[model samples]
Target: MASSTSHQNSLPLPIFSGENYDFWSIKMKTYFMSQDLWDIVDKGFTTTENPSVEQLRQERKEKQRDANALYAIQQAVDDANFSRIMGASTAKEAWDWLKEEFQGTAKVRSIKLQTMRRELENLKMKDSEIIKDYYSRLKGVVNQLRAYGENISETRVVEKILISLTEKYDPVVTAIENSSDISQLSVTELIGSLEAFEKDWVAGMILH
Candidate 1:
């Protein structure tokens, strides 16, 4: 049976660089789901021996769809990545190839995670850096840890922010520490209060 939907307009977003695999994976998943073709990409179709005519036709269509999706994905990536997965026979094969290429071996990923943990533990907001910039740097490290499969809690992030900020923020940090439970505080809430204090402090300095 022919598919009710047309896939002629289905276009892949772009090739994913190895470093931003998580973001690229999200876009690719959404694109596949939108085109009603994720199943082929996720699980390749197998042909059965002595199949009926209808079954053979269905299998052929499945292969064609998989090929199209694979091409779309291939178009968006760099030459090196393209060359790596160019020999894949199906969309699932290509997907697996990309995953392994970006994620590397378990031992390598473990080492990467350990390094990120050390960076997070030793993170300190530079004296010249603003609150927003510091927060972004902190979040980047946290997100990388997550991409590597470690689970970081909101409280842990909040604690890091409070302790690592510069001495000028000491009064605000002390206030927050005394008034609120650091373990229960969200990073969002902590940032909001600190940013407000920052604005006021800046305004006071300008007036002086």
Candidate 2:
């Protein structure tokens, strides 16, 4: 039972392909942290010349941890991505090499982020689209923007949804705006309210 519980605690590392570098990196970092290997990956181990007995023991332990970290990274990437970091001797080297190859330069990230921002701004709930589908589309754009370091607040997202909804939702939107504190309304709560309103609206139309 204990062994089964321990096995369950070990999460499978997320495999990295050529795309979604931001999400993959985040997941990898978290995985490394869970295994207590992030320190070696983030800041590599250093060897001391003519070390004392205790220092030598610590060095051996660190070296083993470093090897484990590197092996974890190697296993987490696909064939193409693994090739990019094949020459890396340390976990930090592998991590940095993959970051440079996939994440691109700061300027490139800035340009991508700008494009995401524009997409978010242009998003609107189509008259025929259901609330669930529209929110999923909006959330995807917001997540990509956030992964690129954009600080989009929940309140801002709530406000965006309120304004971007179609004219058919105007009455519900107005009621929500007038009755509730928009600043405190969570995205989940707003979605629920809108979905409930949609069901009632549809039922009314059917009756008419």
Candidate 3:
């Protein structure tokens, strides 16, 4: 004798694969069809066109800061010996290229550089980008993400990560970079040396 069940269950099959495949097919179709979407929506966009004098000044400053970030990420890659799938010069580019190589279900493969000019060409992707990247991370991480798009932007989040890291670790990293022996430097001298190290860093990132 066999028991009858209301739930028609075969072996517990993974529905996620089916759902995700459907989502990708739909997303790609939508993207291909959305030719006029950017023109219409981006009427309100923060354009890279005709930046103000102050904006130009800030761009110079940001260029320096951006270079530092690029250097730091380059150092991370060099120190970690993590190989690259594509030859991207900057961290953002490298990260972007790597994602395309590694992730399968994403909508776009290659993005134009002009698109990243301001907020990386508005591809900066509000919260949606983070959600997309979050999905690519360890399976469970996306569940921890907050609901807002601005919440994931560098203006609020990634910059916080950068600033906190630079402030907190800059002192120790500076001491290590300058001192021949970490044991030899006095604490006060160590602090002073770290401040001076920024001259070299600023020159590399800001002026150059």
Candidate 4:
């Protein structure tokens, strides 16, 4: 039991620092589940007016679990974030408070999601940007959309990239479209092909 406790403590917790609450909450929930503490944290603990010996023992066990869950949450947040939940007496209360404060209301999330969608639609690869750098920029928006519950498929992402590249890539894009099924191509494969074409293009210019 001592060794088991040590092993559990050795696992790292995702520290929340007010940003990316969606990602942090997902990680924290998985951590709580791994520790077998999510149930108490999610549903909270209840007490009965009158209880038998077994019931009392079970209640004590649950109380201990709740305390453990609360402590884990306290440890997983920074000092600034800690103050937000300082007044919470139960793990469930702390969790819910953080969710409400950071995740915002459903309407706020919908508005934010719409803004992200607009950003994605307007994204384009700059003529001066390398394939990897442009892909990184595109991926950041894609991840934000996904974290906010958008269903963005790889094929959709691939198509978006194909249309967003600068005119210098038109020849390679044409070749790719002609030779391969765009729907079947992975982002990594497309990026690899574009990067190879870019290297040759650069070398040809240097030779001239």
Candidate 5:
């Protein structure tokens, strides 16, 4: 088997941070699955009481996979989180530990929820900010809210846009609400329509 240490040393990105755990988790899981190490982390390797030669070889493969998985995980976390999982004997153990540390606690969830709620409430589309930039900011907050287990619907997001945007967006908002089913509209479509209006508005200004 290839040395897991080599793979660990060449991480494409830096370790995960608490604030970006949701994105980091998805990326890391994809990496593990691509490398075929996720199986060891998902279902531990079992060995027979009296192993045959082939069984021993299989056991060795499982052990190597576990080691590689652990190494990959260690590279994706900070020293503090590393310390929490350092004592884990298998990749599954380390994975479970990290999940619990980051996701299992109500305290963590509450803190994350509070922070996202505050950001959403205060979110505004700045006059200088382009439509794409403004929508990106809103989408980011919504994604974070979902990551923390909040069920934020598209209608709520549309409402946020209507309430938070500047006067320039008011006409677009009115047209959208009056002409379209807000609940049926995806956030992407809403952003695209508003961006089109912004382009027209800019063109009109240039012509004048």
Candidate 6:
């Protein structure tokens, strides 16, 4: 019986081309590789470009520096905005907050060991960047409240006043957008129109 079994035919294994072999090899390669693996490159070498701790640290530092810089810009703008919106009421409260939280771009540019900003020139971030981020933050708050089925806070009541003031500043933006009309209206006339708008809106509010 053992001799008979030894004489039995074995099945023929199919031959694979170099391309097919490469394809299968690649498929297997992915399975055997670690997350950090660059490739099983050159038949198993240093294996991957595992960043050195210092490199990792430098990356982290750069990220934090950028974050701090953007944050500083945002806080500075927000604080200035808060003061403008709060008018006389924001004096003590806003000053303390600013001292604690709002670092100007210049100061952020000066942060030690940071790569965020340097030279007063780079510190001059575009006005569009500030306005974009400001509106984004404002939109985010509105979205959050809507999503949560929540009402705006008293804090946001103040924000509403600021939003109104910001809206009132629109004529200048329009003039800038359409350069021909910049001098068509005096600043006094603009202010007077805004005051009149406030009066009418207030009267409507009372009547309703």
Each candidate: what lDDT?
A: 0.84, 0.89, 0.36, 0.91, 0.83, 0.37
Q: If the candidates were sorted by their lDDT against the true structure, best first, what order would they fall in?
A: 4, 2, 1, 5, 6, 3
- Per-model TM-score versus the true fold: 0.76, 0.86, 0.26, 0.83, 0.67, 0.18
Per-residue alpha-carbon lDDT of candidate 5 for residues 22-135, written as tens digits (9 for 90 to 100): 777767877887778778887867778889999999898889878888878887788878888889988899888877777767777788799889999999989899988888
Clashing pairs in 3: 115-121, 116-120, 116-121, 117-121, 127-149
Over 1-208, each residue of candidate 2 has an lDDT whose tens digit, in order, gives 3553354247687899888888998888888887788999999999999999999999998887788789888989999889988999999999988887787778887788888899999999998899999999999999888777799999999999999999999999999999999999999999999999999999999999
lDDT of 3: 0.36
- The positional error of residue 188 in candidate 3, measured at the CA in angstroms, is 43
Better of 2 and 6 by lDDT: 2
**What pairs collide in candidate 5?**
none
Off by over 4 Å in 1: 1-12, 17-19, 33-65, 181-185, 206-208
Top-TM-score structure, candidate number: 2
Residues 16-103 of candidate 1 have per-residue lDDT tens digits of 7666886687678778888778988888788889999999998888888887778777876788778888898888988888877787
Predicted structure 3: clash tally: 5
Query: Where is model 2 more than 4 Å wrong at Cα?
Result: 1-10, 47-57
Q: Is candidate 2 or candidate 5 better by TM-score?
A: 2
State, as a TM-score between 0 and 1, how close model 4 is to the true structure. Answer: 0.83
- State the lDDT of candidate 3 residue by residue for 30-122, as single tens digits: 432332222221121232578999888766655543344344333333322245522554445543443354442244321322222233222
Which pairs clash inside model 6?
A: none
Q: How does residue 100 of candidate 6 score in lDDT?
A: 33
Shift in Å, residue 107, candidate 5: 1.0
Every candidate's CA RMSD: 3.5, 3.2, 25.7, 2.7, 4.5, 27.2
